[model samples]
Target: MTDIPLEHVHVAPDDGADSEPAPAVFVLHGRGADEEDLLPVAAELPDELHVVSLRAPDPLQGGYTWYELDLSAGGLESSQPDAEDFRRSLDLIVESVDAAVDAYGLDADRIGLLGFSQGAITSLSLLLEEPDRYAWVVALHGYLAASYASLDPDGIESKPVFVGAGAGDRVIPESRTTAAVDRLEDVGADVASGSFPGGHGIGPQELEAVVEFVAARAV
Candidate 1:
């Protein structure tokens, strides 16, 4: 079996115990950020969830990246991931999550995902690849990759997905975010999307909305 190489930070549920398994939300940060970058956001999440924030395996700009980005189709610095690296990273995450279930005694059926920017791209991609695997998802300021654009969605049910993007974001661009939302909805995923005013970062309203979104569904 391959090794799970991603580093992580796990926050136990507030009213949880070792004997009783709790639901979990695995968090993935944006490019150039680490496991701890999403701690504050994790703190604001529902207390019933055991939050596990993972560091991307590859390093970039003194931080971490899920995989090397492919800019060959260059137009405004497209953030499409290098296909092979992306696959490897996805395997790492899957292994790491399976291990977390064994190690932390988390509820496998209630696994959720949250991410921003490049991390969002990964999260959304994972959701598309395995619709029934995740209970819910939140992808911020990230778009769908062209790789999994044609997945068979007949197996997907009413999976809840919350998508947030800054109207002024230029890095990944708002249009890319909208495209992601459209794709998710097209695949029969229940998507809640909002375009806020900002640039490449989450605003107060976005945070509040995300917190509420998770709370309503936390197991």
Candidate 2:
């Protein structure tokens, strides 16, 4: 399970140094999306970033999802995310990150995480549980899972984060979105955020902010 299916995008170093370790970003796609879904976003990011996108372990309807969502009550809820599956997926992500660092000779301290929807939830969960492994995070159109509500501030305080959502997103209600941001801020994460005037997906303005967020953290 640790050997996650991956698609790699190598960006050439501008300095022309053969051995200089370039910064890296692990791109996580939304529910029912594949590894290729976020590759374009990676391309728009700063050049020379080693991008590693992973496919979710569980196969869903026609694509992939990180975890199972129980919306039996007609509300967007994930109070139960297949605990065993989540553990396995989370473990694989950590293992993959470490392996990627070793194989590419990349600086672990410079690695950032970018994700959307379910991907975003996993990214935030991983960061909250294991903050030392990543430098920053960009979580789009997602909320903090109920399981991770009691995150310890000591482990993640001062961590850089960019959390964005759509004002018209019906899938994740505004209340949940607001709570997600408030949770992160209460935990002392350096949170920079924006809301787009759209639905349950990312938009141009959000992408622009993402670019700026990545650039600022890349330094």
Q: Which regions of candidate 2 deviate over 4 angstroms?
A: 1-17, 72-74, 77-80
**What is the lDDT, from 0 to 100, of the residue 167 in candidate 1?**
87
lDDT tens digits by residue: candidate 1, 24-124: 99999998999999899989998889998989998899999898878888864475899999999889888888888888888999999999988898898
CA error at residue 182 for candidate 1, angstroms: 1.0
* lDDT string, candidate 2, 80-104, tens digits: 4566777787887888788888777
Consecutive 10-residue window with the lowest summed lDDT within model 1: 1-10
* TM-score, structure 1 vs. true: 0.95
| Candidate 1 wrongly placed segments (more than 4 Å) | 1-4
- Candidate 2, residue 185: the lDDT equals 93
Q: How does candidate 2 fare on TM-score?
A: 0.90
> Which candidate comes out best when scored by TM-score?
1
Instruction: Give lDDT per model, in order.
Output: 0.87, 0.80
**Clashing pairs for predicted structure model 2, backbone only:** none
